[model samples]
Each structure stands twice: as C-alpha cells, then as structure tokens.
Target: MISIPKDDPAAPDAFPAAPGAPSALETPASPSEVPKETSASLQMPEGLEFYAPNYICLTVFAVIFFPPLGLAAVYFSSKTTEANQNQDWEQAYINSGWTGWLDVFAILIGLAIIYVYTLYM
Candidate 1:
C-alpha cells in the first residue's frame, strides 16, 4: 500500500479540478434546444430491402449445390431487372428460377462425368 504526503508540493487539493471542465452544479440544456433529427429518418434502397432475403437464400443454395447454374442465375436475374422499368418481383423470381436451373445443370454434369469414367475403366 502507498500513502500521499501532506507536505508534498505536487499533492492536489481535496477539490482538485481541471481548467476547462464544467462545474457539477451546472444543468444540461432543455430538450427543445437539442437537434430534432434522428437516425430513423433515413430511407433504405427499395430493391435491397425487398429482394435481399430471396437473393441470399438462392445464392447460398446455388453455391453449395451448383456453381455454374448459380453464376448463370445471378447473371440473368441482374440483367432482366436492369432492362425492365417496373422491377416488381422480377428480381426475386429470376433469382429463384435461375438458381434452381443451375443446380440441376451441376447435378447432370456430375453424373455425366461419372458415367464416362465408368465406361473407360
């Protein structure tokens, strides 16, 4: 344990304070004086909020089961949505359909390779 020396010139007073610190007795400003703007005022992109869930699920399934088909689906859906003026459910539908097709393609390719190897050996 350590003890402070009373006679030391470097020792601080009991009520020691900083030069720029606000006094404890002072009160904060009223609510009316504070800014009214809040983070909730900001708006997110419509496409992002609408299509994020479908896009995520399709992309995940594609990656795990069919890389090529997944790539194709991602490519086509992006294109169709870009071409149309009224996006509607275009993005979601395209993504799901394409992802499913690609998965099927991948499964077929795997089967073909297996068949060829079996025949040769």
Candidate 2:
C-alpha cells in the first residue's frame, strides 16, 4: 500500500489562497476594453483552392465491387487527403490521380469478373 506524507502538498490547505482577480462573469466597461483578435487567431484567406479530386466516394463504391484494388484506392485516397491538409498541392494531385485510377481499375476489373463468370456458367 502507498502512504501519503502528513504534509503532502496535494492537501487542500497546503497552498495559500490566490490574489483577487476579476471574475469571468464581469463584462468590460467599454467595447474598446474587450480583447481584440490577434494574428494567432487569424485564419488563411478563402481565395486559395485545390482542384484535385480525392475520389474517396468512388473508392468506397469500388470496395463493394472489388476488395483488393478497392483497398489500394482507399490508401491512395487517404494519402491525397493527408497531402492536401499538409498544403502539398503537388503530392495531393499525384495521390488524387492514383486514387482515381485505382478506383476505375477496381470497378472495371470487378465488372469484367462478373461478366466472365456469367458467360462461363
């Protein structure tokens, strides 16, 4: 069993009371007294845009039709999203292209398999 010292700092009376501070419920006397937005709170402008398509939906659709290539497409789609979040437009574009191609290939291959199975049997 663990034992705490009699003078443990974690005790409620161990520390002195803090100095008086203004309560959060109090409102500023004037608008100017309110805190202003700082550069740290600012966000990037909305003008910047990325044209790459993540192909996540198509990848999910492909998963229902084909598991192997569909899973690969999902990986590429996640990479595209990660690159986009990192602001690496080039990598995002490349990953998006790979995701799109994988999605298409998975769907096509699945259809081909179904067609061949129906024809043979």
- Predicted structure with the largest lDDT when compared to the true one: 2
Q: Cα deviation of 59 in candidate 2 (Å)?
A: 0.3
What is the TM-score of candidate 2?
Answer: 0.61
lDDT of 2 by residue, 4-116 (tens): 67787776654444455335677788887766664334425541376468877899988988999999999988898777666677998999999998899999999999999
Candidate 1 per-residue lDDT, tens place, 32-111, comes to 55444432343346644554223545555555555666667567556545433234455656654665566566656656
Question: For each predicted model, how many residue pairs clash, with residues at least 3 apart or on different chains?
Answer: 1, 0
* Candidate 2 Cα errors over 4 Å, as ranges: 1-43, 46-48
Clashes of 1: 1
Model 1 alpha-carbon drift over 4 Å, by segment: 1-67, 73-88
Error (Å) of candidate 2 at residue 114 is 0.7
